[model samples]
Target chain A: AAGMAAPRRLKPLHHVAVSGGTHGNEMSGVYLVKHWLRDRSFAATPFLSNLRAVEKCVRYVGRDLNRTFTAEFLSSAETEDEPYEVGRAREINQTYGPKGSAQAFDFMFDLHNTTANMGTCLIMDSEESLLPMHMCHYIQTHYTQSSCPIYLYKLPGEESYSIDSVAKTGLALELGPQPQGVLKANLFAEMRALMACALDFIELFNTGTVFPAFKTEAYKITGRVDYPRYPDGEISAMVHPKLQDKDFFPLNPEDPIFQPFSGEEILYEGDSTIYPAFINEAAYYEKKVAFVKMEKRTFSIPGLHTLSLSPSP
Target chain B: MTSCFVIHEAPVRRVAIFGGTHGNELSGVFLVKHWQENGAEIQRTGLEVRPFITNPRAVKKCTRYIDCDLNRVFDTANLGRQTTEDIPYEVRRAQEINHVFGPKDSDDAYDLIFDLHNTTSNMGGTLILENSRNNFTIQMFHYIKNALAPECCPVFLIEHPNLKYATTRSIAKHPVGVEVGPQPQGVVRADILDKMRKIIKHGLDFVHIFNEGKEFPPCTIEVYKIIEKVDYPRNKNGEITAVIHPCLQDQDWQPLNNGDPIFLTMDGETITYEGDSTVYPTFVNEAAYYEKKQAFVKTVKVKLTAKCIRSLLP
Candidate 1:
């Protein structure tokens, strides 16, 4: 129990513990946290008074904090044997408990950024959880000016796990593909407004007020392409240009990669495209592995209404 | 008297084309006609054009189908079959239309194809098919929604992957159906008529249709099905009854817990219990009930073949 120093007098209302940036590469969520910390006025609103006044705020920088919330990781914190993010997650959990008590914090939000090309999405653990979907709808409705298609997926249902595995309720706001400079700034503001909306809902829930349910029109991507880094000359270096208006990438099967000394022919084997073929060696991870766009079905769902079926007669 | 016109334009590369299948849904028909009437100006402005009218009888009748629904007759076998009294007229019209715009054996085929229409319901605007999650269709879906119906949010782009396949009789063609809202009086019909004109003009402007020099949006072929007909319960007096209550356009239908009554008819009542199943309810008036000649559910499962898969692949 690393940060279990003392049980201070809580404001006796619900608290929201937002933690994200689990993947060091994804930067949107980090900027969102930074935005919240800088724009204190959003957090200062009456809706957030209970937890805002007493709850200890912990912000983890660098490293994936989501993977560290296990019992072994917590025990290792005492020995100082675990990585910094792991130890930090342990400390946060100790202060908040495995599941933040009902008398304390009632919600969590994990923010993240995906590859710049993948569209915007909200990732959750269950279709039954309406909170994340509601927040997704609000953000898409209020913030994005263009036709920003918002997608929602159940975490474990999709064969993936995240920090939501630890918290009873949490939302992972995935900002599709990170743009370079000023656009990035605008993306941060959009993310901040989204955080405010989530925090606002949490406060309403704690006070027994009816939180406005989020209306959602669900969609799923139609195709994806993964570009895994292969041996020295295996992965080719060629510009995969996008067809006009179409998302298809034109890649010839016979293109070759020229490394310092070796070269190999490129094999185009997928149903999608890969643009900007340059590699950033600094990021040892696969250069650019995946591209996904939905075969979208846009149908509206009632706010906070997670019911899969229509009301009976 | 009702007149039908079919127009085709190949602005630049002739990547995609437009076909108005239903004459009653005259927006697309009129739009194509307007372009053809102003052909020289449009040509001077640079748009390669191709257009055709599908069912003149239905256009004259102001109904969905003429004889048999012309759209449902798209399966290959039905191409030349005289299935009804009007079969000769429809077949002749289809042959002439097919020869003009159907896929040529040459590689230079129209990139995208749109079949425009108007719905009987007040719900107006465009509906896009998500047969292929290609960039052009996705962008067009967004562009049309943002540029046209920003207020009613009338543009609906289907995002689901279609598990079932639909065959069109007019030869092998990638088709999309656009439904403008139902217009009864000729004046209101004119409003939709003008909107369709603007959409065609804008589409021409976007693609720079005739100007062979400018780059056009790369086309992605796709296919989708619109609810051509619906079936609803009718009363003893043959009055159409509303099954589920109508709510706001954006409102979510509430979930029924345990036992909930679905509908009440003079033929007795139908209730849904814990284990019983039901379909999504559609609002229908007696007029619509009669016009809804087909059930809303998919009764047949068509086998997916290698040919169909090849056709869909880019």
Candidate 2:
């Protein structure tokens, strides 16, 4: 396994971690931190990042907080320019970061829920991150009823812009196929279990149990696909009914991807099979992404490779 | 000009046209902004038009609102509050708006209020959501219905149930909310905007004719009154386990009988509407209310005896 060159035992990573609704409308993460805030054993700092947007029941107050956590944005962000999220990112980085600084927290688990029925997923920024792979494997295998699929979403050397990117060690826990602003209790319990499992994996690593080595498969995001647009830039088609909420499902070469205003099926022209996620995401409608395409790959635990996401999704 | 039953005495009618109540819906915001800049654009013989945008900051941000929904903040208990740091953005805006156009119970309030709104639901053309059965509101509905061609601007009136004037339009003598839809928030469709502008003009003309003591021929107006809100079929944990069924999608204004498939679960299980009687559903799968878990609202058709100037005057 890659990155297995470390001594048999590494120090137990009990440094600080934080997670909750980075995007205000995602209620599962918003409430998960809320539950943690009440528990006494919780040492990690919890936050409801976009409190204003939560109250209003919208996605964000200023802009999407998830996309505003780059080092560049943290350094240059004023209380203006994507006003609410940018300022908050600066504050989060100061408290938990000066991002990628090893002197800070060991990891920050960012929780999120999607409008697409993506179910439970562990989103890793880089492919080379070994610890996350083993951890995700443990969760997926242990929880027979619920599979924890890994999705590597990093683009070729692009700096991470998500909330968890500020941490030296972390991953984004996305739970969904749920609607925005609505709290589903079952998903709530599942998210809590996943968080607990993440903590347990860290504890096992710290205490020096020789983890069983295994090759893992992950779907790496290749790029996004947008709805076809007319000359005036208005979308000319919508996601076909066949593909509405089928996140992580395969797109066969001739699969119908979109249904145009004329009601004709627009078939996918790609030659090979690919997985699509975030299908018909309500929030992405404004950003013009119909869905993100992912290519399946096999990587040994702790391997990072350069992958390019398509230009637009 | 259409002939009318003219009466002797004249009455001055003050009408308020409110837009951007939910600021992200651009059609209303744009129309009100247009009128705000060019006040002389819309005119009628005996009517006074007051055009206003309800939530300007939200409009500026191209958001639904800076704080809470302005539409839900106009309840009597929430209105007229002194501005404070703790006060929500919408509550303060609602209070400020109340001073200018409302305190619906007061004599100083506008004679009629038309609050413009948009929805992402498949409801298209002109959808009028009015709560009260006041004769004036019904007459205006009928006038607009007759004004538009059948295929062009088909008007659908939904009688919303009001709880002490919670909505911005509810705080008036004759409040009518014009909801045109299938348009996403922040999108400006020319055809939808033009339909709204035409309805605003019709509202002015209808009220003008009323103020002139002219009577429309007494008529029975059909309207749908909301009775209940139906949510998505949810699991024990409140997560919706199913989606709106294919057969029920975009079936607004059609009679839905009991046992009709309403939702289809992930497991391929179909759930049907359990109500005893057939009811009409509006706002089917409205994107905005997904957070509230309300997939649609069920309503029943009722007829109103609508008379124009005579009913209001007498």
Candidate 3:
């Protein structure tokens, strides 16, 4: 069988962390983590990352906390005039990661929500690491009951800036169509179920179960398109209504991408078809990205066996 | 066009200010609550101003409505429908409201009714009038426009001449729907709330001046007359495929010309305006209209001339 042979044995996972409220307005993650905190389970641990932003119910008091985890930001000296997220990022680094260190947590899961109509997206950095890829493969196969699509963002050439990057290996669970301040009950339940599945996979991996090699599909980020803007920098066009909630749908060249206030259609000028993610994400409005362009890729993962008998010191 | 306008000679006596007609619209609901507790701000010498929350259940739940939209349930056909067990809460509420404030186009209706509303669209501060021929509403719109800073008020005429309206304010002799926005459905913006309060204050002040028998000079004002509504692009399954384009999203009250982008399809195609002439679009991307199947309401600019009026007093 193509998916049956085993080759590599990876170390058993020990310290797995789940984070929420990275963007305070994402209510599903925030509420799920809050519920977990109330439950007080030591085995299934989760924490709120941005307390100030969560308290105020705003994205962030200073700058986006999720984007403040880079080495440059973590290494920057403390200053009274610096953004609130900068100091908070350093504190988080000390707790979870000091980055690329052996002391870092074994795995992490960052929770997020978007105003864009992305449904149960599993965002990973890249396909370089084997463990995360295998985990993703497991999740994709096991979480078959719902629309769980995997996405590969922050490709090799791009710098990693997300909170999940602090761990040895991790991914972000981004769910949506939820307005910043509002939480849909369905999404909240879906998030809880997804988190539980991720935890189950960790337990399964740690228990020394052999996993078969399998081919899986993921959308990899290629580029981002910004909204059409005026001379004064005011956005002049909106994401075409047709494209608004069509996340992960293949967008062909010359397809309608934008509609200006003047009522003219702007076609996609790209040569090849591409899928889009984060379409009209409310948070990305300030970032100038209307939507992220993606290309679908299938990766073949090698079979994995846990190295539980020989624990690494 | 210099057409003669016949101004209403009756002095406005009782005025009703309604809020929470759409429960998610927080500006009006909160303002009504504030005024109900503190009456000093809305009080004037001759006018008996009353503040009311039309749909308390919706307001309490922070939803638009329970069974149906309260604002759209006030039509004569719905109002006259006999009470039944299966009747919607809003329909029953509308009947009760009609019994209290209106008989529907009768002489016993309130002299002026100003219904407060908010939109998710970026329509600054708007005065929605059903009848542009009514001089009282037009003059009030003109006064509010001049009293506040420029661009503070824009008159929108729905132009329903059939003597039938399903809106909360339409029951009054002179009705004005005060709609302000860019505020999210469930969220309140301090700027939007302040603008709404100012509009109401000026409206009451105008009524006071009219009751005191002041002569008003003839003036011409710009009115956005709604012609038709545009719906979002939908597939065979009736699922909306596109949304209001970003450039046209908040561009309410702005001119739309032929070949201008109106909708962006999910397939990455731009749907431009194919209209032969330029028209103004209002209520662009209203959140509440999603279920109504309306993307935006198209309008044309027309000059409305109002003649001088003096309130008749003994």
Best by DockQ: 2
Candidate 2's displacement at residue A246, Å, is 1.1
For residue A270, model 1's alpha carbon misses the true position, in angstroms, by 70
TM-score of each: 0.35, 0.58, 0.56
**Which candidate should be chosen as best, given lDDT against the real structure?**
3
lDDT, candidate 2, residue B252? 79
Candidate 3: regions farther than 4 A off? A1-313, B1-8, B160-165
Sorting all predicted structures by TM-score, with the top scorer first, yields 2, 3, 1
Q: Model 3: which docking level applies? A: incorrect
Worst 10 residues of 1 chain A by lDDT: A45-54
lDDT per residue for candidate 2 within A176-217, as digits (tens), equals: 766565555557668877877777777666655567556878
Proportion of native contacts in model 3?
0.00
Q: Which stretches of candidate 2 lie over 4 Å from their true place?
A: A1-9, A51-58, A77-82, A302-313, B1-62, B65-314
Q: Give the per-residue Cα lDDT of candidate 1 at B159.
A: 34
Native-to-model Cα distance after best TM-score fit, residue B164 in candidate 1, in Å: 6.2
Indicate the docking level reached by candidate 2: incorrect
